[model samples]
Target chain A: MLENFKFVLSHTTHPGNIGASARALKVMGLSQLALVNPSNFPSAQATERASRADDILASAQVFVTVEEAVADCRLVVGTSARTRTLPSQLVTPRELVELILQQPARVPVAILFGTENSGLTNDELHMCNYHVCIPTNPEYSSLNLASAVQLIAYELRLGFAQTPELPEQRILDNEQPISREQLSGLLEHFDEAMRKTGYLKQNHEKQIDIRMNRLFSKANLTHSEMNILRGFLRSVLYRCQ
Target chain B: MLENFKFVLSHTTHPGNIGASARALKVMGLSQLALVNPSNFPSAQATERASRADDILASAQVFVTVEEAVADCRLVVGTSARTRTLPSQLVTPRELVELILQQPARVPVAILFGTENSGLTNDELHMCNYHVCIPTNPEYSSLNLASAVQLIAYELRLGFAQTPELPEQRILDNEQPISREQLSGLLEHFDEAMRKTGYLKQNHEKQIDIRMNRLFSKANLTHSEMNILRGFLRSVLYRCQ
Candidate 1:
């Protein structure tokens, strides 16, 4: 599936960006890299920037034009920070992941990244079926090219990576969260501790009780966590006596 | 919130990683960057690697000690590859995001990343209450320091940048976590006061010490709470004096 996708850098001014882009793609298990008229390919700066990912730069496919870069691609997605005036489907990085996952078997999916200053040209953007925008602060939406690639690549990997299923809910039957009785017991323990510390001299007991209850409720304490708390409280009570 | 999260790298080996980390944080709308005991900062390697993210590097904070770097921060989360045998709680990147979002208004939160070859040492890890681990392949879990920073910074941005209704948990509402320095001061004050009252004459100090530590740790006293406790202790000390 990684081999089928092509990440094309269009008119990239810096050779270092190309190298960094290669590293980003390789980390996410995406290997195919196509460069459309990079300023200086096969340069020492790029190889230095690629670090351990030199293989990506070595085997990179160089193209003279954007048209040649993504001609055979089944789907093309261009990355942009601004909302274009043209009518094209704009999706966030996560949403683009969902789109890619829904059709993993598709061949030659091209991700287009434009020049550093202006981003994808209108004609180049028109070639894409969708535009992918990484959500950033509206006040300062300037994102580095390689970083943008890294994020989009990460989303792709997360969508494709095989992860272990999350542990199933461990709640026992007849136990809906913590019972009111158990909550009251926990509150009493807290109140007793406060009293020992001379913190609940007034009717502040009610406020302390309410606050403690809220704290525990937010924890959604598991059975084991609850046991630990109870054991600690018991020890405290025994010491106070 | 964005301005408050300072990404501090300690003893960073690779200048490129520093640059990449800057780009990572910028893409996520976080700006503050700090370097503690870096091997070589302000090198051309770093500036070139930073690409257009030189602004972040230009304004980066350089500190000699991690303590100094995080002195102003109220919350400190250390990024680790795996959980150590320490009693510190392990939270995934997503959970850490939630925790950071729940921090009280405008308090600084420091996210610590160690050198590239060997991640944060036991001493550094001990400084943090929670260890945030980014789930990576166990077989080839060679995540670069900057990549780890990228993932965590991304999660933090997602958790805190959105404009949604306030979370129901309100976990950090009233309990502000006490700093290690504050905790140390309180412990010293307790010891002195106990000695003044003859509560620690015959090795009873050990038992009382353990109990007091547990009590304060469980309470999760904030900065203000620590001040209050110190104020109370001062009054008692005055009476004894």
Candidate 2:
């Protein structure tokens, strides 16, 4: 799903911003980047800023106009610094993610970011169905061009990328929940141990039984946890004898 | 509430990263920044990289150790490159935001980022209640320090900040739904116009009425839309005469 997104920077002045934008996209698992009439290309400054994301810069497509850049895109989104008087619906970056999710058919989405000083031009904004504005400090909204790309790419990653399970979670996946029979046997063991240890008084036996059952159910003990508990119970029973 | 959160960079090597981090925080409407033994501060390079967020750099607190930096914080979250073999709960950036939302009392949160080469140390990870790992391309997870800050700050902003209404949406707030009586009158006008145009036949009058009613109900037309439709109907009725 992330492959469907292509970030298009139109007439970006800073070569470093272009490089940083490539790095940003690569870090978020996005590879496609389109340049529309950039001031400089194949610049050393860009490669230096890109760090090890030179591959993204190498594979980046360059076009003469924004029209050609997003010609094949199904959904064109323009990033604006502020709201404008236009028919295009304005949305927050977060809301834009939801919009993309709702419209799965709108693949090969192109997100347009204008020059550093000014955001998307009126003509570019007119082309977009929605204008996404990253919420910033009302006083100082000077977000770096690369930072803006990083922000939008981050939102798209969160929206579309499937989160891989942690190593610990994968390890724990091997341990299944104990069966009902195993749980009942463990409960019986607990009952015997409690009786022998004089913990389960005759008058409160029913209460203890109910509470223990509820506790075990709440814990949802796995096979490994049940083994540990059963071992502890066996030790307690041997000690009581 | 953003003021309650602080970004702490420990033993950072690059001054540019510090400056960029400050800019990142400011862009996301966060102020507090604490550095632990940075290689260089009060450097011209730092200010240059900070763009115009000099205020954040000037107010940044310098700490000798991570413990002292987070002493006042109610919650400490460590940003890690990968999950470790520790007991601390590991979570994605999105999950970390949800965790913060769940624990409203855990204010004054401190998010710790380790050196560029190495992420949070085991000792630092031990201090955190939760370790948030940004999901990146497994093959190339080389996210820049400031870029990482930007991504995390972006998520925090989206999680906490209330999205302001767009100017267009605010303008549309004045448009109220037409009254039921007005809708009925409009329906009557539509019926008369259809009859005059011979579009509504004797045998299919009920069908036309039902379809028109359903279409109008589905549209949920605003007062302005109602007025436009009424004007169009009036024009049609005059033409019939």
Give DockQ per model, in order.
Answer: 0.19, 0.13
Q: What would the per-residue lDDT of candidate 1 be over residues A45-138, giving only the tens digit for each residue? A: 8887676778888899999999998989989999986665754799987898788778766667999999988999988988988899877766
lDDT of 2 by residue, B54-107 (tens): 899999999999999999999999886555585588888889899999999999
Candidate no. 1 TM-score: 0.71
Clashes of 2: 0
Q: TM-score of chain B, candidate 2?
A: 0.69
Supply candidate 2's per-residue lDDT for B65. Answer: 97
- Give chain B TM-scores in order: 0.77, 0.69
lDDT of 1 by residue, B1-241 (tens): 6777899899999888888788778877889999999999988878876766789999999999887887666666788654344324467777777665665542577888988878887557655656676654333345667777777777777777885644554546446566646665687887775565444564455545544543343344565456544554454455455
Evaluated at residue A106, the lDDT of candidate 1 is 60
